[model samples]
Target: MSDGPQRFAGHQSSHVDSDAAIRLTDTDAVTARYSAVQKGYIRDPFTRPLLPRGAQFQPSRPPLINVGTYVRSEGIDSLVTQWLELSQQEGKKCQIVSLGAGSDSRFWRIATGPHRNTVSAYIELDFSENTTKKAMAINKSRELKGTLGDPSNVKIVGGGTTLYSPVYHLIPADLRIPPHESLSQAFQLIDSAEGPILSPNLPTLILFECVLAYMSPAASDGVIKWFVDYFATSPEGTVLGGIVYEMFGLNDSFGKVMLNNLKARNVDLPGVEPYPTVASLPNRFLQLGFERAYAMTLRDIRRSCIGEVELERRANVNF
Candidate 1:
């Protein structure tokens, strides 16, 4: 009978506290982009504005980190390109949903690029803070102004509401906390297939860029199952698939380092232990009702896909 008011320090273990902390950790991806080119990571010409005005460099990443970035970005790029081309050929439109999209700059890059006409809509969802930062940047920047529409048309509201534009929509919603409940709530904000926003009948690419790893295994599975459910019930010829990029400790020295780094950031890899291998990656989705599933490690991808020449060139910037 000696308990008093709970201490604030003990609340650090709560989900709310962890979620906010991990958001800061997520910013590392943005900082890394500025040094990606110099570090031989990858080419990203549209990510600078998404970062802070006077952000510092973060070049002290695993050299092989470039391979991961390449695999994720190149893979998405290839998928998006093909999706766009096929849509153009079929004279249909498609949509892209970027989960935990933290000032990613993908919409602008894709919308203004050669395949600009292909993508009908691009939606980025994350916490309201991140969405607001991205929305504000898009509002203030000239590059992203006409990309969506007259800045006046862009709508920004508080939590649970979406910042809607003609092409790009920055939505603030929790991913998979509820059993299809939160997603259902978020759906109310989106236009239906018959409406003008994005065609629900068309193909969709849902990207989880190192986002799911932070979530518990059950929660991540909920996300996959939700998509499968949506595809199963949606109109015919509605293609749906996704890609997940994450680091599962390899049980090696590098794995230990990665684990320690993330732990230091107060971000726990809850799902990593469950699916630790490339083969295990796809099976996670296959079990969730996906027709096909495929995954490869960064090194395997570098050796087989990038080949000797490109890998050799990339090796110049040793980690």
Candidate 2:
């Protein structure tokens, strides 16, 4: 419903290896507001403000392919902000950790916006190479850096993390490792940032944006199961939520061609075969110890946010 399966209908590597693709994608995202890019996201007020002052970049695809990217970013921002506000209204402490959050500016946008007080802590996890680049991007920009309280009090540690921000933290940790070991280290960073030990029992939300699809099903399963087990038994009644945005329908007609293209690059999508459809994903999550799981499709994004009227208007935009 987000109005552009037509947008995605038209859709890699730099210095950091496989992860470089993510960074470059984000690089394009920051400058997407430039009039020359012709993206619908040029209208995304949140995105433009989050970018550093002079982010110039080249287009990597025909503009149509990026329509879906911007729409999805807008939709996800709405989703996360809605939840954060709900948690705040309920008087619950909240933590949101975005997996593979490459140069995404959700935290800074939310922190400085009207709902700035909604979340207690926000953490971003990515490879060190990407996180360091993001940190520098934030620090160099007076606008980006201003959102994190007093500028002089801010600090980055281990080359990729902010060790002293009360609300914003950038953590560089490998998600492919055992979840307990990797996530515990991430939580400790949060503990330090927030000035308290993170209880196993805390209201937390984990966001995986197409990150799980790159992993083997076994690895993804283990991570989800690990989280379920860790928070399910908390005496304080910690409620947990996971918001996953995954790529599915691979091995099918349109997807098969795309999958093969990625495979040629030696990118193995181990999770594709195991959970190949959005419908299949919730069942997979339930089986992995998630008591309840929900999924939103592209159509849902269109219908739920942008209405049919706007969709038809965009349909007429010649690309």
Candidate 3:
């Protein structure tokens, strides 16, 4: 979902002039969400307000894609809601850092939800171009801007590429670069009189939705390791959870077809080449010194993670 500097083996650059194509995936992701919202597959009041003026008129995606989007969104939502609830159980508020967050309404959704107070901070990082567009969209939408508390408290920085508020922050970052180099800009920003934007004492959750696939394994690992080390220096019991939604098992024929389909558009999945199976996906974090990690497919989540009644409800709702 992000197009940053990519480094691969035996090649200086495999994706020359492909940043635009990689960024186009963000448009596809947001459009898919909008389509699902329009089809009643999901309830997202914020997606529409943040979309481009004429994006809504585009035709809805196919039924299969809509259902897939529903499952993926619900699955991630379950994990995030559980993280917030867990923090509440511990009598603490948690923070969420969503990487490659392109036109995602998750921060707005969580800020307005029941567990809003359970979240101490919600930070979103992405390419500067995407962040600039999202910042403009947010500033242009009253409903979106109103959720950030007092208008006086919200200000756009980085020449309108970044927006800051009481509990929400949108910062531009290239995940391909070193975390210290790319992420220090965010670390330097002060959320309030609170000293630092990110609190090391609080539990944090790193959300990677359809990201990391475009970068090399080393780059992606560095990003996660940076967070791991950052929290390791914090107070004890500072939990860190990561949720990465991506496609794996690309060595098969079906995977080949999917890869070819994407390659036709000039996009590559270098990171995915390392984790080819569901079982191997956890190694992405486990090897980074995380205590535990797990991976599940959308189909698995739909079958066991969701209730039968909810499944029936979704099934009965046709496009």
Candidate 4:
């Protein structure tokens, strides 16, 4: 789903904790997805399970938001599907690590979708509090816990903050912290008697959806570089792909207004300020040693990548 201004501001700014506002962004994301699902803009049965019980019933987001969510979800789904298919073509399964993953049901979707077998491992990392809540929700849901294979294999460790299955893992992590201290240690849990959860030989895809904008450029780059270095020594010539969905170009009038609004709520976008234009978005990866990278706004994707039927459907929904 798209992380628009409306979604970021979905929760009331009444919490005294600073990171509470940050964590609520996940609430905004899941609720927006629920809204889109209710409006016939998307199909996601798993999203409902991940949402808090209190937020299960809510009015639909505006038509524009529904459309944006549709486009954003479709676009990322397309890329992830392609990654999985590419791994299949190479006779290999891929690993996906979603940083700052909130109440996202992507792993469940991929595991049940056609590309289910193409994923060797699916890992999600988020703040400890969010992970604990998600872990509890998954623990309580039959549909969600069942997808992780045998209930016996599922272990809730880290004092119920981490859940691990054969193919899926939900771990608590704060991305703003140093990756070496945070990521490297957390990954150790994935190394089992079978092998490491993240094989250096396999193609890996790092997803940074609506996350990078919440951190400093240095911290965000460190996260990407950590992954880059992890696969750099692979003799198999492993390919590491990255996808970042964020807001940029806040110097413009509309952008300034959006920035000011977030600022008013104590949410600072230090990561976005570095990339003021779509043209500069690729630099986020390329400069960090990615062989290639591309940036496409929701507008361009809607105009070119989306089919006429979908556009017409969105138009009808809007009208």
Q: Residues 32-136, candidate 3, lDDT per residue (tens digit)?
A: 899989888899999997776688999998888888888899999999998988988888989999999888999888989989899988999988778989999
Candidate 3 vs candidate 4: which has greater lDDT? 3
In candidate 4, what are the lDDT values of residues 214-268, reduced to their tens digit?
Answer: 9888998898899999899899899999887888888989899988888887888
- Shift of residue 69 alpha carbon in model 1, Å: 3.6
In the range 1-319, model 2's lDDT, one tens digit per residue, is 0011112333422223554444454455456534223544334333544454465444444555556654576578778877887887888778887877776767876777777876777887777766776787777777777778887677877744444576777877677788777777666754354344344556888888767877778878877887788777789878788888878877668888877776676566677787767779899888987788888887789789777776666544545
Backbone clashes per model, in order?
A: 0, 7, 0, 0
Candidate 1 Cα outliers beyond 4 Å, as residue runs: 1-16, 38-41, 56-71, 159-161, 190-199, 314-319
Candidate 4: lDDT over CA atoms? 0.85
Listed in order, each prediction's TM-score against the native is 0.84, 0.81, 0.92, 0.92
| Candidate 1 local lDDT, 132-151, one digit each (tens) | 67777776777676678776
Single out the weakest 10-residue window by summed lDDT for candidate 1: 1-10
Native-structure RMSD, model 1: 5.5
**Whole-model lDDT per candidate:** 0.71, 0.68, 0.86, 0.85
Collision pairs in model 3: none
User: If both were scored by TM-score, which would come out higher, candidate 2 or candidate 3?
Assistant: 3
